[model samples]
Target: MKTFSMSPAAGERYVPVSCPVCGESRTREGWNCGSYRFARCIGCGHLYQNPQPHFDGLRARYGDDYFSYELENDANFFDLMLKGLQDAGFFELERKLGDRRRFLDIGCATGMLLAYLKNRDWRVQGVEICEPAARYGVEKRKVPIAVGTLDEAAFQDAAFSFVHFSHVIEHVPDPRAFLLEVNRVLEPGGYVITVTPNRAGLQARVFRERWRSSIADHLNLFSRRSLVRLLSECGFSPIGWKTWGGIAKGMAPNFVKAPLDRLAKLAGFGDVVLVVSQKISRKPQDPPVGPPDGAP
Candidate 1:
């Protein structure tokens, strides 16, 4: 895995750090790729790249070719994403929320999903960290995009009812603080869904450093236990979870690969995992005790 320290992309901005979730200084060697090494936090079992790029440095690494590459290659990317959303029970959240129309997609690159939803009449807002990416969404796609990180987006309290971001949590430097910001903007019982790589899955176990997730930019990695623990700590209630992907065993026909993939997920050995959680209502104050049934 090419790293910020070795590559010119990140420049002289890399620094060593402790685990963001557990604040643990002790770590076990998890994997090494190129010039970087990943460590598993002894306190929480979270995996992270020990010396990662500074925020500005990481931001500077993304270039204009980011979205256009997908435009040229994965033309049906959004369609596939919509299908994945349905599979992940996003529509169920829509049904449950009923009248709550606002949706926020963090790290919404090119605002494709937001633009798609906006066409369907949902009040959509997006936040993208990359300026070029965010500007494309705003200027080209005509979507409402705020160009910044989640904590810097400055959304109002309880501003949205549904929040979605795929494959972004792992890149965050501090996931607990990131989720806290996510929780702050979501209304009570609002739906939140995220997809990230599963370290406990077969892909990581088999390929080790060769897994797509073993990269310099992916700062944090989580298993089911660590993911739920972090979410619960940040006040998100569990809704649903499932492991998927990890079809890297071989190039077989879908007829063969599909069942094996399903079995892999069912047995908790998939590469990617989907988690649906919600921001629950804060604990209420003690119910008002009336004084003698109408004392002025």
Candidate 2:
């Protein structure tokens, strides 16, 4: 739960940019946390960290301790993650995609989730950005992990039946390309489950500029509408959607958690969103008809 502070080095890495998901320029209303700025896109109504740390900046910031910070350097990290995955979103994927074929975890980090999936008879593979984190997964957790970015890994086309990631897409420099890569590796009718902090969630509304999810490292903060739109554009058709519930934790005393959550989730205002989508056919369209080759 420890948030990364925007250091002088990280700040130096910042270069002002526009919205990645939407090509439109950033709106005037935005908040500055230290020197970093989070802006909303006028076109898509999405919030993102403009002037975010580039790939090199991200690499410099993560270094060695980032994994330790993420793992909490705790012995029970895998155990804790297993329980949470089952209780949270894993079962939903399982129930939908009954047969477990090939599974790939993008930005798997220490491979806790991938390891758990392996236990369920899945042929699991992971791609991690940080070397230390990838090594930890391969060495200690006994998970098969590739050390590099998604584009660098070069997985085979239609190689995986299920591809998953939590809170990782927001960190990518180009989510559109990232998802297209994901679609490339995923088999036809494959399932993809993605989770990210929701910018249009209750907490974001309540906190406004002070929302915790609008942190330094998180580059894209998506709402359900924007996220689902991204998925459709990337060739994934959403089958199910649910917000990672925090209404019970963060709701005020006057608010009733259950009823509020039912309504809030439908309205796409949850702290996090768990989206289950199936990869649709992305084949090239046939050439337009004019006349026969000899006739025209």
Candidate 3:
């Protein structure tokens, strides 16, 4: 894995703009943390940090050090268990689809999920933007991966039976265009699954701006309603959905955290949202456009 170093910017820059989901321009607000400032659209309730870095900039951030940190600090026994649960979710998705011959995983970091799917006899292919990560997948795991963005990757249309984007949508610049491309490359009855942070979750309410998930990389925030609406607009039918899992479960906590963890999981407000939808031949009607005054 290669690492590229670059000088940090002296200050943050803000760009005022209307809401992308809705055309309301009146309720834009600024989110400031130290020297960083983000222009959040109150209209559609989308929070985006300012001075968004380009693809190369992101690649530099995800170098060897980043993976080392993830492996050392993030990936543990509990993390492994959580990953198993996530793979179980995908397994259920596979059953629903009734077949799993081909699978495409976008933003497949280190190709762990693809490796898991491959074990299930699904031919796994992945598209990753970071060079080091893609190389690791190809060389270490022997997973076939296209080392680039989805739009730039060379894959035939309708090549995949299952397309997945776990925790990847928020990092994308254009969610609609991304999904449109997903639809283009998917077979007529293929399934598309996405998992991302739900802005409307209880964690968001408790942590507010300081929520760990509210970071510089997440350009879009989607609540359950908003996510469903966006998927419908992009021509996917909602088939299955699940909400939050406890953070304490990832930590070696005693009995004190157990009850709270159970409650949080029951409330479906942990920290992440998973959605499974299938691609259909007919396009669904667009969601009713909200008012221009930020009234959702």
Candidate 4:
């Protein structure tokens, strides 16, 4: 594994939070990529950053230039096609719902997905952690974006019919708690769609920690098995899921963009994973009624 130095200023501070999945205390490990501080949970083998940077800090790290870079140089055409693929997932969700329904997108960076769904007449709302990106989405794209973390947002429970969180779960401090919140906001039988980098993929094995997905922002590293387990524990029943190599993964590094980069598909090393799950309403367990009288 390639090792990187830790910045003295960045490495000096971090707050401790219990493991999101196992509820275990996390101990500091070291600095990763000279940018992110790392902590590992001995109970669940889940790694995270202690006292991770806030949303504002993350926004500073990924400025407006980053989106432009993605739009202009980094796999631009391929990403558009990937959007179509993501829409296909949304379409499947529509079929499952049997009606036009509201959709909530977490980490909706530039509102591309929200815009796409809006065009299809689905009620679209988004929660974004990056203030600049959220502002840009509202000002430039006219998207209905809420700027902040989901926990801080004032959305009512059981409001949304569908929710999508693409590549955002790994960045969360508490995956279990986050999913519980997702369940609370989603109506019974509402679908949750997620796409993440597959830690069990061949590229992960070949590249190990050097895999591009293992960047500074990524805290939790989850294999497909682990992700499935986590979701099950969080009260979601798996609808369908799959693993496939994405074209952009291969063409992203080279400025030479393609409609669909075939290197990973051809070599079979691309590391994209898809999961679809549904929220099941748990039967309300009533609290025992206290004795009417003052009898002890």
- Assess every candidate by TM-score: 0.87, 0.82, 0.81, 0.75
Residue-wise lDDT of candidate 4 within 1-296, one digit each (tens)? 11122123343444457666466784546335455545556565555666665544454544555545433432443374356356447566687676648999998877777887788778989998767778877887788999878888978998899988877898776787788889889998888887777766666555655666667666576655556667767767777776655433343555433323345444434476667888777743222332211100
What lDDT score belongs to each candidate, Candidate 1 first? 0.76, 0.73, 0.67, 0.65
TM-score ranking from best candidate downward: 1, 2, 3, 4
Q: Rank the candidates by lDDT, best first.
A: 1, 2, 3, 4
lDDT of 2 at 240: 78
Off by over 4 Å in 2: 1-11, 73-100, 247-268, 282-296
- Going through the candidates in order, what is the number of backbone clashes in each? 0, 0, 0, 1
Give per-residue CA lDDT, model 2, range 14-66, as digits (tens).
66767666567755556667667777666656677776677787766666767
User: Candidate 1 residues 36-138, lDDT tens each?
Assistant: 7687777766678887777776766566555555444333557656867888887777877777789999988888999888877789999887677788789
| lDDT of prediction 2 | 0.73
Which prediction has the highest lDDT against the true structure? 1
lDDT of 3: 0.67
Q: Candidate 3, residues 204-295: lDDT per residue as tens digits?
A: 66665665666666666676667777788888887877676455344446575566656655786656777878887896688677642221
List the pairs of residues colliding in candidate 1: none
- Residue-level lDDT for 232 in candidate 3: 82
Q: Work out how many backbone clashes candidate 1 has.
A: 0
**lDDT for residue 160 in candidate 4, whole number 0-100:** 95
Q: What lDDT, from 0 to 1, does candidate 4 have?
A: 0.65
